[model samples]
Structures are given as C-alpha cells and as structure tokens.
Target: MASNRPAPEAPYEPSRHPETFGYGDFRADEGPWEEWNPTEDSLQQVRGRHRVAKQRGGGLARSSTVLGVGVIAAVGAGGMASANTGKPPVSIAMPDLPSVDSLLGNGSQETPAGSGTALSALGVSSDDSAQGADDAGEALRNRIMAQAERQQGQAENKATAAADQRILAAAAQAEKVAATQAADAKEKAAAEVKKQAEAERLAKLAKQYTLPTSSYTITSTFGQAGAMWSSGYHTGLDFAAPTGTLIKAIHSGTITEAGWAGSYGYRTILTLNDGTELWFCHQSSISVKTGQKVATGEIIGRVGATGNVTGPHLHLEVHPGGQATGIDPMTWLRGKGLNP
Candidate 1:
C-alpha cells in the first residue's frame, strides 16, 4: 500500500547560509545513515499531530495548508505520468467547497422564522405579492373614479349655471314684452275715451238747435268771392229753393227786424238771448211781425226772388254780438249741431 506521508526536509548547507557560520568539511557517505521510507504507521502518526493542532485553535490554518499540499502533489503526479507516456495532459476539475464560516459552524444557526433569508431577501411569497398588486390596482381605480366624479360635478354645475342664465334672459325678455303691451293698451284706452266724449257732446248740441230752411239746396257758402256782392267776398250763406219753400228760426229767438232792405229783399232779423243775430233775406212773404217771439224750427218767411236777387233763394247771415260784420253762417250752423 502506498504511504500518504510527506517527504522529509533536506539538511541546510553551511555554504548556503547567509550568516557567517562554519562547519568542518562533511561527506554524505561519512555521516551515520539510516534507510528511511514512508509507511502507513508513520502517516498515522502525522495525522494524529494534525488532529492535536486542530484542538489548539489552529485547525483552519492547518486545513488550508493540507489542501494546498494535496493540490501540488496531484499536479506533480499528473505531469510525471504525461512526460513518461508522452500522452496529452488531462484536464482537472475542482469541486466547490463550503465557505469557512459554514464548515466551522460560525454562523450556521437556523434562520429564525420571519427573518430575512435567501427567499425573503428576494421577495414575499406569490400570494403576498399578488395581494400587494391588487391593493395598488384598487387604489389607482379609486383615484380615477374620484377624479371622474369631480369632473362630472363640475360639468353639472356649469350646465346648471347656463340654464339659469337662459332662464334669467327669458324672464327679462318677458318683462319687456309685458311692459310694451301694457303701454299700448293704455294708449288705446285713452284714445277711445276721447272719441266717446266727443260723440256725447255732439249729441247734446243737436237737441238745442235746428236748420233755418226746409227743402233748400245750398247755392253759396260764406267767404265765397263774387262780383255780385257789395263786399269782395260773400258774407252770408245762400239756400236756393222754389218760391214756396219755408224759412224757419234757427234757434229760440225774437224777431228784431222785418220788411224790405236795399239788397236783402223782404228781410227779417232775429236776435237770440245771447245777443247773436240771424238775418234772413230774399223772402217772398213774412210770417211774423217785428218783436214777435218764435221758437226753434218755427216758420218765419217764404223763399222768393225779390229785390237784388237771382232766382228763388234765401240769404242767411250770422252776426255775433250784433257787430256790423257777420261771420260764416255755415260755421255757426255746424256749431249748433246742424251739418247743413
């Protein structure tokens, strides 16, 4: 059996020592010699020394030294075999070894539960990791929903404001239209009231007066320009009719004059209570004496073509306050509520 003991060290030569030392010349054959070869018993004795050193706190250093020696011996043997057979050198593979801490049990206590280990340092379990992911997704979804709700609320507020604005605008327009309609209605009411008052006044006047002649056609209006009159313009109104046409009092009055005049033939003058005078000329015959009282529409004379007159007609003149000049008879008659 092969012995596992290491070779013995050679003796140091005096000549090789750097220190000045001398020894008597010696021969290798002259020294007392003993034939020494390795044996299993000798190897067992060296291994026992290694175990003893380990107990003295030198185990780690000794183990490194032993491993290095083994590697060198293995390489030397492989080299020698290759040189002798002239074959290609073989490749050697090394096995992984445990760290010093592991081999010595320096930090080899079982990891406490829930403490950081290889797996814990990397991450949590699949279930825990999935739960964390779900929580994050739910949080994001809640944030998105909250934001959407806020935006929706803002949109609704804006829409409500717009609707209110439109309502306000419509209300303002309605108010304006109502005001205009009220004003128009008020104006119409005022105009209607004024028209009704005028009609009532005219109706009262019609009962107080009457026309002077019956069945007579108007031949001349007051203010008519003519060559036949003494004045440049006609001062009276003329009524043309047959000789038998009757002339009557225009209102309740007393006869002031009767009989012939220079241009007004068979003239008659009536004076009203207000000192207004009505003159009827060109009469065929007189129906009342002077100073006689006559009622409205009572016959005073008959139509004739008498002095200074053209065919049968009545010339009527009105004098207010008995002035020398007369006003238009047609206007006075209209004021008394007679259209003719």
Candidate 2:
C-alpha cells in the first residue's frame, strides 16, 4: 500500500528527454519523427512480415493442406468462366492460353513443330485471308474451263479450214478437166468438117467422068469364046468385013500393045491413067510394039482374017486394067471426045 502513492511530476523538458515508447529509443527531438502511415500496400507488407497463420495440424502437413485449398479454389473459378462462355469444355485444360505449349512436356528433348500451320510463324496479319482463298479458288476454276473451251474452238476451226481446202482443190481440178474436154471436142469438130469438105470435092470430080463403055448390040462381045459365054461368040466385037479394013484406037490413050498374036491373030491394046485397056483384034497388021504410045483415031492395026477365023472380019474390044472381059469400043471412043 505504500508503493501505491503517486510521485511528484518532473518538469517538461522536450529537448532533454524525448522518448515516449522505448521501441526505437526515439524521442520527440530525434529528427522530424513521424508515424508510418498505413497505405494499402504498406499494410499488406506489414501483414506479410507477420508470422504464418496458425494451422489445425502442424509443420509440413499444414502447409500442404493450405496449398491444396488454393488449387481447388482456382479450378472452381475457371469452371465457372467456361460454363458462362457457352463453349465446349476443352479436353486439355490450360490455365494460360499462350502457355499451352507446356502440354508437350518440358523440352529436355526438342519437340518437333507442326510442319504446316494455319497461322504463319511470322506475325503477319490474317485479315481477309479466308475471302482471298475463296476468290483464288473460283478464279482457278474459271481459267481452266476457259482454256478447255478455247482448245475445242481451235480444233473445230482447224477442221473447217482443212475441209475448205479440199473443196477448193476439187473445184480447181474439175474446172481444169472441163476446160480440157471442151478444147478436145472443138478440135475434133474442126477436123471432121475439113474431111467432109474434101469428100465433096472428090464426088464432084467423079460426076464429070463417064462410063468407059456402052451396052449395045453385041453378037460377039468380050469374054465370049468358051461354052461358058453367051452364044460361044468371040471375045471382041466382030464386024464382018472383007480383009484389009481400017482399024483405029477407040480413045485418046497410050497404046499398050500392038501385036500379032497366035490366038487373036492381030491385036492392039491401049492404056489410060485410070488403068483402062482397049484392044483391036483379028487385024491385018500391027503397027506398034509392046510399049508404043498412040493417040485416038491413029492407025494401030487393020482388019484381017487370021488364026482360027471363020471368015474375013474385024474384032474390036475395050478392057479395064487389061482384064479378059472387054467393054464396047464405040462407047469408050465417044467418052474421050472421039468416035470409032
């Protein structure tokens, strides 16, 4: 009870003794002393400086329990965010989207990167890339179709050009053939006309000539010596006259023969350009040889009765090409502008 008595107060000396609490031994005079103002960061630092909170258990087990509680809370918050977004649950959940490369495990061994990626390795902007890809695809398809159409058109044009060439060639050949045929026909017609004109001139000349002999009374005509002849008459004209009568050529032609023949006794033959022969037989005398030429009416032989003659007579004959058959001498003489 005696110690409880109040002592007397000392005099207030601020500069001499300044300590209020003994924690830092600081006094009011130590420099300008101030209390640590409690900002939120400062307060948290103060709380961190305090000791760990007391746990139900102790030591390492207590720390492990607190860590487990923190992990569970983080998982619950992420699940809530995913459900609210209405997106599918990711099979491989990653807390940090950019840090999802950790799923490949720590790269103690280098991991292979994807060969092809939707995004370029370089940070290029992907603006409008999908639209650009669609446009490129459409453009490629259109180009391919256009090329096919152009090729088909070109092939058609080539075929048409070839056909046209063939047609032109055929037309040219036909024209050439036609021209040749026309020219050949023209030449043939000209030749035919020329031949016809020549034939007309020859026919006119033949009309001017006359028959070498005339059909007249022939009691003894040419080719009448044998039984095959009519009446078995002599082969020439037999003009019964006394021997030594005048004989003359029937026409103005060369005399081919004047002879004394055994069968005919005396004979004279003449020749003309058209291969005609004239004869006078059974004459008195022959005035010319084999090749002697004589004119019409010129004396060549005379009438005589010689060699197998029945009586005194004169035999006159005319022949063509010296054949055995004789024509009428009187007609031949008149045809050459003379008379027998």
Candidate 3:
C-alpha cells in the first residue's frame, strides 16, 4: 500500500529537505534556477525517487531487527563469566559500624571490629554506676578536707591571739611589781635617815635628863651609895632638887608603864623604837599613861622623893633593851654624843 515508482538515475546528495524536493537542481538549461519555481513534473520525479529508496525488500529488514537485539543481550551477559565471588559482604550503620575496617582505614587495611582499648575510651559497655560513685566520693572527701582545714586555721588564730594577750598582761604585771619595789626601797631609805637623826637627838637628851634638878647636889653616884638603897648600892643617879620639879621624857617613845610603883612610887617607863627603855622614878605624880606616846622634853610627871630617896630629886635610869643590869649611865650617855 505504500508508494511504488521508478527509482532516480542517481543517489541524492546532502542538502536541506526542501532542496531535495522538486525545486532542487531542476536544470541549469533553464537559466537562473534561483528564480525558477517548481512544476508538477519536478515534483513527481522527486517523489518517485524517494519511493524506491524507502521500499523494504524480502527478509533482509527482518534479519536486521533480530541482529540489533542479539548485540544488546551479548554485552549484558558477559558479567556471568568467571564469577569467583568470595568474602561475604557486611552492612554497618550508626550505633555500631561493622564496615569501619573496610570503609575508614588507610592504604587498603582491614582492622578488627572489636577495639582492644577500655570500654570507656571506645565509648562502649562502660559501668555508669561506678563512675558516678567515684565522682560523688571525690566531692565528699574534698568538702570534708576543706572543713577540717578551716577549723584548724581558726584554732591557730585563736591560740595566737590568746598568747599575745597573755604576753601583754604579764608585761604589765611585771612593770607594776617593779614600780612598787622601787617605791618601797625609796621609803625604806627615807625611814633609815629619819631613824638615824632621831637616834642622835635622843642620845643628846639622855645626858641632860641625868643633870642636877635645879642645879641641886647629886647626892650619890651609881656604884657607891648610902644604905637607903634596895640593890645594895646606888643603881641610878640622883638629882636633889626642890619639891614639885618637872619630870620630862628623855626622848620620843611610847609609855609602856605609867603609874605609882610599890618602891619607885610614881613612875613612867617609856620604850623607844630601838627597844631602849627610860625609867623615871620617885615622881610626885604621873601625867602620862600606859600606851601614850611622848616626845622629847615632854613633861610626864613631877619630881619628888616619894620612895627610897634621900631627898627630893629626880631618879632616872636608862636601860638599853630593858635589861636589869645597867651600864654606866654617864659613859653610855656620853657615847651618844651628849653634852653631859
């Protein structure tokens, strides 16, 4: 049912589809073909030529379709030859990559899937409870140590402060003691000077007390005397004077006894600070009392011959340390730097 016609005398050359039509190369004899238009004869001739070339003849076309299919099948079937498949393939993915050896190592290497390192380093199969316990224990130990250290430091500070306070207190006390001792020493020195001066004064007055009462006769010395004495001899100096003469304390002292005695009659005994005793005997009347302090030249009683005395006179005795045996009153008084 397709076109059937005689073939052209020659094969068509390469040109546009329009140039291969009836308008193409009609004849150079027809001058100026670029200007020539196509007619029915040229059209029929081109169509008839294409008709013979496109016509399929016999089994050659069917054989060409079968050959094309055979060539495609032959190339794809070549992979089946020498199929020596070894080594089972493995699939690895996230969480555990089995393909790490095949995929990641350098220079064509295959490494073991299970790592030889610790589980923690490999981030696999580690003990979570033990790690947490260790962290908590370390924190607790640190807190305890810090608290103990703080307490120790506070104790040391308190001890240092206490030691400083003790040192200051001790120093102050020592200074106070030193000042008190110094004052005591100064007072003692002044007292010693006053005592020496007083001693000198009393010594000078002792001789005068033995002087004659109103310039009267002595009547008797200490060693030899008349039979009117109790000690077998005159034990004291006797001053013969008028009645009612003044009897004075020889020196400053406290009166230890002041009253009438059985034999000495009115008497006063004064005790000095150095324990020397002054005895005034045969007084007409005593004006001082026991425990009374008297000064030098102070009138303590009146002179009278009320006892074993020859006449009206002052009987005076000096007893150092209040002993019974008496020393020579004249010589002792003179040694005290007295005028007598």
For model 1, residues 1-340, the per-residue Cα lDDT tens digits are 7655555656533222221111234323222222234355643655334432223245436546765676677666654544344434445543223354543334542222221122221223445445555666677799999999999999999999999999999999999999999999999999999878877776787787788877889989989998988887888998999997988888888999999997888999999999999999999999999999998889999999888887899999999999999998988887776898
Q: Distance from true position, residue 71, model 1, in Å?
A: 37
Q: Is candidate 1 or candidate 3 better by lDDT?
A: 1
Clashing pairs in 3: none
Ranking by TM-score: 1, 3, 2
Candidate 2 segments whose C-alpha is farther than 4 A from its true place: 1-233, 328-340
TM-score for candidate 3, please give it: 0.38
What TM-score, over all chains together, does every model reach?
Answer: 0.54, 0.31, 0.38
Could you tell me which 10 consecutive residues in candidate 3 have the lowest summed lDDT? 80-89
The TM-score between candidate 2 and the true structure equals 0.31
Q: Candidate 1, residue 153: CA error in Å?
A: 6.5
Global lDDT of each candidate: 0.72, 0.54, 0.60
lDDT of 3 by residue, 1-340 (tens): 3443543444322232222222334422211111112234533655333422221243323434553464344423322111112111122211211142332222232223332222222221224334544556677789999999999999999999999999999999999999999999999999999989887786666644433234556666678755677777877777677878877666678999988787887788989888988787888888888999977678888878887666788776778899977666666655555433
- Model 2, residue 49: distance off in Å is 99
> Candidate 2 on 170-231: residue-level lDDT in tens?
99999999999999999999988987876675455334433222332234544556754344
